[model samples]
Target: MKVLVTGGAGFIASWCRRELTARGHSVLVMDHQDRRHQLADGEEFFLGDVRDATAVTEAAAHVDGIIHLAAVLGTQETISNPRPSAETNILGSLNVFEASTQYDLPVVYAGVGNHAFRLVGTGCYTITKSAAEDLARMYNLYREGGRVTIVRPVNAYGPGQSVAKPYGTSKVRKIAPAFACRALTGTDIEVYGDGAQISDCVYVEDVARAFVTALEHTAVHGPTERPVEVGPLESRTVNDIARLVAEYAAKVTGREPVGIVHLPMRPGEVPNAVVKSDTTTLQQIGMTVADFVPLEDGIARTVDYYNTEWLPGYLAA
Candidate 1:
C-alpha cells in the first residue's frame, strides 16, 4: 500500500518508515525537510510542513492512508511559553485533519500518550496534545465522511531521538543520557527535582510498530476508532531507570557513576503514569505489545548510541 507519512524523519516516524519500507509498502514522507528527516532514494520524501494543508493534501493525494506524527513537542513548550507549541500541536493537527477531509483518506492520528495522557511535567505539550488528541476522535464524528484513527504513545525513546528539542520530551530526553554521560565523563548528572517520579518509555522501534498497528487496526475496525494505545508492556520508575543507566554505562564504558542527584519533582507531575492498557481491546484487533526492551537494555543501547552517534558529533572542541 502507498502510505503518506508525515514527520517520517523523526525518531519514531523514521523507525516506522523503516518498518513500512521493509514490509514492501511505499511511503511518501512529508516533513519540513529538516536535516534530521532527509529521505533516501526510492522513497518519495518531500519537504512539506504538516501545518500546510495544501501541501499535505497534495502529498497525501495518491496515498491509501495517512500517518500523522509531526507536532511541536514537550512541556517546556507548554509551561515556559505556549503559543507555538499550542499552534503546532492543536492547529497543526486540524490542518492534517482537513487534509484527510479533502482527500477522503483514512488517518492514523498519532496523538499524545506519555506526557499527554499519563504523568508528564510541563503544561503546554500535554495540554495541547491532549486537546488535539481529543479533537482527532471528534473529527469524523463532526464530519460524516471523515475517517480518523487516534494512537497515543507514552514515554518513547531510542535512536534518532532529539536530546535537545527543549520541551518536556527533551527534559525527559536528558534523563537517560545525563546519567550515562555522567558515568562516562565523571560529571554531575542534571536533575530537575527529587528523583522519585515514575514514568514509562517505549523503544523507538516499538513506537514505530505501534504506528503501523494503529493504522492496521483503524483499517480493520474502521476509522472512527476512539483511542488506540501502543507502548511497552509496562512502566518503570525514574530511580529504576537511572540506576540501570548508571550500572550499564559503567559496564559498557567502564565508568562507574555516582548515585543520582535528588532535586524537587516538577509541579503537576503525576507521581506515577504506569499505564497498563486494557490491551485486551488492542488484542482483539491483533495488536499486542510483544517487544519491550528492558530499562537496562534501553539505557545500554542509549549509551552506545550516544557514544557512537550523539556525543561524537556534538561534543565541544
Candidate 2:
C-alpha cells in the first residue's frame, strides 16, 4: 500500500513510518520539517503544512490511505496559544478528512486517549483533538464507503521526546521527559497535584503498531465505531513514575536518587485522568495487553536514552 502520512517527521510518526516500511508498504510523508534526507528508497517526503488545503490535497494524490498525526501539541502550549492549536488540530484535521473523502481513501487518525473524558473542561489540546475526532466520525458517517479509524494513545513516551523549556513558544512539557531529564542531572523531580493524578503511559513503538494494525483492519473490514484505545492495562500515578525515573537514573548514572517535589496542578489539565482501555476493540484488531511493553522496561529505556543521547547535547547547549 502507498500511504500518505501527515506529520511524518514527528516522534510517533517517525516510528509509524518505520513500521509501515517494515510491513512492505511505501510512504509519502507530509510535514513542515524537511526530513527528505531520512526517507528510504521507495518512500517520499513532501515539505508542507496540513493546514494548507492545497498542500493536503496534493499530498493525498496517489496514496491508498492517510495517517493523520500532525498537530500543535502540549496541554499548556495549546491553552496558552489556542489559535494555532485549533488551526492545526481542528482545521488541519478537517483538511485531511476532506482530502480523504475527495480521494476515496482510508484514514487512521491519531487521537488523545483521554479525549473521551477530557472534553468537558480540559485544555485546548484536548478540545481541539476531540473536535478532530468528531470530524473523523462525521466523515465516516456521511461519506459513502468511508474508512476512518481513530487510534487514541495515552501518554506515549520513548526516546527522542523533547525536554520542557521554561520559556518557549511551545511550552510542551511531557512527564516522562521532564522526570527523566531532571533525574539524570540529579535535580529534583517535580510532581504536580500532590502526585495523585494517574496516567497510562504507552510505548511509542506499541502505539505505532496499533496505528498500523488499525489501518490494516479499516482497509479490510471498514471503520469500527469505537476508537482503538492504545494503552497499557495498568495505570500509574505521577508519584510512581517520578520515583521510577529517579531510581532508574540513579542506577544508570551511579548517582544519588533525585527528590520528588510536589506542586499545585497546572491549569487546563484533568487532575484524575486515567485511560480505560477498550479491550474489545483491541481483541477485534488482534492485540492484547500482553503485547505492550512493561512500564519499568519502557521507562528504563527512556531514561537511558536521555542519559546517553539527550544529556550530552543538553549540557553542551
Candidate 3:
C-alpha cells in the first residue's frame, strides 16, 4: 500500500513513517519541512501546509491510505495562540477529511487521550484535536465511501526528539527531552506544580505500530466512533519520571544525579492524572496494552538518544 503521512517530519510521525516503510509500504510524507528535521530516504515528499485544501488533495491523490498527524501541537501553541492552533488543527483537518472522502481513501485520525479527562490548562489544543477527531468519525458515518479509523495515543517519547522548539520568541521543551537534557548537563530537572501528575508514557515505536495497525485494519466503519487507544502498560507520576531520568542520566553519563526544581503548574493542564489505555477499545482493534514498551526501558532509550544525538546537535546550533 502507498501511504500518505502528514506531519511525517515530527517526532512520532517520523517513527510511524519508518514503521510503515519497513512493512513494505511506499510512503509519501507531507510536512512543513522544518529545517531542524530531515526526511527519510526512499520516500516521496510533499512540502506544504495541511490547512491548504489544494495541497492536501494533491498529496492524497496517489496514496491508498492517509495518516493525519499534522497540527499545531505543544502547550504553548494552544495556550498562547488558540486562534491559529484551532485554525490549523480543526480547519486543516477538515481539508484532509474532504480530500479523503473525495478520493475514497481510508484515513487514520491521530487523537489525544488527555481530553478523556477534564482538561485543566490551555484546552484549545484538546478542543481543536477533539473537533478534528470527531469530524473524521462524521465522515466515516455520513459519507458513502469514507473509511476512517481513530487512534488516541497517550504521552509518547523516544529517541530522535528535539530538546525544544521556538515558541513565540522563546524556546520550550516537553517533559521527556527537557528532563533528559537538564540531567545530562547537571542541571536541575524542572517540575511544574507539585510533580504529582501521573501520565502513561509509551515508546514511540509502539505508538507508531498502533497507527499502522489502525491504518491497515478493515473492521472500523460506522456512524459511531470508537477510538482505539495506545498507551504504556503502566502509569507513572511526574516525580517518578523525574527521579528515573536523573538515575538513568547518572548511569549513562556517569554524572552526579540532579535534583528537581519545582515550578508553578501551567493553567489548563491537569494534575494527579494517569493516562490509561482503554482495553475494551484496544480489543476492538485487535491490540492489547501488553504490547506497549515498558516505561523504564523506553526512558533509558530516550535519554540515550538525547545524550548522544539531540544534545550535540542542539549545542552546535
Candidate 4:
C-alpha cells in the first residue's frame, strides 16, 4: 500500500512512517515544514500545508490511504491562538476528507482521546479536534464505502518530542518533555494543580502501531463508528510522572533527584481529571494493552533522549 501521511515529520508520525515501511508499505509524506532528517530510499516527501485544499487534493491523488496527522498542537497554544489552530485542524481536516471522498481513499484520523470528550468549556485544541472527528464521521455517512477511522491517542510521549518555546515550535509545555528536561538539568520539576491530575501516557511507538492497525482494519473491513482509543492499561498522576522523571534522571546522569514545585493549574486545563483508553476496538484489531510499552521503560528512554540529544542541541544553539 502507498500511504499519504500528513505531518510525517512529527514525533508520532515519524514512528508511523517507519512502521508502515517495516510492514512493506510505501509512504508519501506531506508537511508544511521539512523537519525530517532524511527521506528513506524510495520514500516521497511533499512540501505542502494541509490548510491548502489544492495541496491536500494533489497529495491524495495517487495514495491508496491517508493517515491525516497534521495539526497545530498544544492546548494552551491553541487557546492563545485559536484562529490558526482552527484553520489548520478543522479546515485542514475538511480538505483531507473532501479529497479522500473525491479519490475514494481510506483515512485514519488522529483524534484526541482526553479532550474530545470535553465538549463544553474546553480549549481550542479540544474543540477543533472534536470537530475534525465529526467531519470524518460525516464523510463516512454520506460517501459509500467510506473508510475513515478515528484513532484517539492519550498523552503520547517519546524520544523525539520537542521542548516547547526557546527549544522548539510548541508554544505550550508538554508534561514529559518538561519534566525530563528539568530533571536532567537539575532544575525544579513543576507540577500543576496539586499534581493529582491523572493521564494515560502511551508510548509513541505503540500509538503509531495503533494508527497502522486502524488503517489496515479500515482497509479490510469498512469504517466503524467507535473511535479506537490507544493507550496503556495503567494511569499515572502528574506527581507520579514528575517523581519518576527525577528518579530516572538521577539514575541516568548520576545527579541527585530534583525538587518538584507545585503551581496553579493552567488555563483550559481541568484538575483531578483522569484520562484512560478504551481498547475494545483496538483489541478487535488484535492489539491488547499487554503490547504497550511499560511506563517506566518509556520514561527512561524519553529522559535519555533529552539528556543525549535534545538538551545538547538546545545548549549548542
- Write down the TM-score of every candidate: 0.86, 0.95, 0.91, 0.95
Per-residue alpha-carbon lDDT of candidate 4 for residues 93-115, written as tens digits (9 for 90 to 100): 99999998888888899999775
Model 1: lDDT equals 0.68
Local accuracy of candidate 3 as per-residue lDDT tens digits, 79-153: 777897798899989999899889888888888978665344446878889888878877877887678788888
Clashes (candidate 3): 6
Local accuracy of candidate 2 as per-residue lDDT tens digits, 1-317: 89988999888998998999999989999989898987877889899999999999899887999999999987766777889999999999999989888888889999887786665577888899999988889889888746788888889999877677641122588888989988888899988787877877888999999999888888888887788888887878878889999999999989999999888788777677655566557776788878889999999989998888888877786
What C-alpha lDDT values do all the predictions have? 0.68, 0.85, 0.80, 0.86
Q: How many clashing pairs does model 4 include?
A: 0
Alpha-carbon runs more than 4 Å astray in model 1: 34-37, 114-122, 165-174, 267-278, 314-316
* Candidate 3 local Cα displacement, residue 155, angstroms: 1.0
* Candidate 1 per-residue lDDT over residues 1-317, each given as its tens digit: 78888877777788888888887878888888754436765678677887777787788777888888887765543566788777777887888888777777777887665544433454677787777777776777787547787776666777656664321135444456556656555555555555555566667777777677767666556663446666666566677777777766667666666567776556545544443343444564466776556655676788788767765555552
Q: Which segments of model 2 are wrong by more than 4 Å?
A: 166-170
**Cand. 3 Cα-lDDT:** 0.80
